[model samples]
Target: MNGNESAPRDAAPRVVVGVDGSPSSGAALRWAVQQAGLIGGAVDAVSAWEPPVAYGWNAPVVDTSLDEENARRLFTDELREVLGEECPVQVHPRLVLGNPAAVLLDAAVGAELLVVGSRGRGGFARALLGSVSQQCALHATCPVVIVRAE
Candidate 1:
């Protein structure tokens, strides 16, 4: 090691982005990838899905294991297809069974940035931001970037 050649001070940071198969999320993914290139960081694509619930007059039941697995597969496939093989940075796919906001917030705990879509499949049409995006922006430990839908 030569004293004249100092170690590179700029280290790659970890970036986490949440996806839900929506066009808005696709934009977020693209944005994250670009940011990763600028910072020489890796991107982790995360998705959260819960099982459908059956509501009855007598009882309500929910089983999410299968749904979670399906979600994982979907997210993985999408990442591979959308990101393609030419991307320079590393990409990781993650899927969990829970509320989207909660899962994203948890993953953001140690990340340098958390990226999300501006809107999702929510009922409210006039809201500026989707519930998940708003929640993450408010509660995430890292910086939150919301990519608006085209």
Candidate 2:
């Protein structure tokens, strides 16, 4: 290769995957890794969280700093569990605080693809009920892929 020529991977596509530390999300993460490898691309592991209600039913507001840290831990653990310590393609872990659908759509702005789990509800039927994957499929600028756990 000539020095003037750039590497193919330098312009590789970016695949964004939503990970919520669930079994379905683990499957989605695996799928993202494989897809990224196939296209010589990278994966953006995006995890979103809110104030939590702050959890249970109408519970009191908890410390947000701790919540953020816990979210990061979950994100890291999920990645490690799914892709292990070493992954074939580059995997960027992103933790954001917002609606899952909004977070994913924002991340997918310039991405080559956006991936999310079926959340046990498959197809357009889930859209009627308003799932994150459906919101992504309908609004993402790039292609959206909904993966289901094995």
Per-residue lDDT for 1-150 in model 2, tens only? Answer: 221222254567889999997667889999999999999898888888876555556667667798899889878887888888789999878888888888888888777889898782333543533388778889999998888778
lDDT of 1 by residue, 15-113 (tens): 889999888898899899999889888887788887899998888887777777787788877787778878878877777678899988887766789
For model 2, state the Cα shift of residue 86 in Å: 1.9
TM-score of 1: 0.84
Clashing pairs in 2: 52-55
Candidate 1 error regions (>4 Å): 1-12, 56-58
Best by TM-score: 1
Give the best candidate by lDDT: 1
lDDT of 2: 0.80
Number of backbone collisions per candidate, in order?
Answer: 0, 1
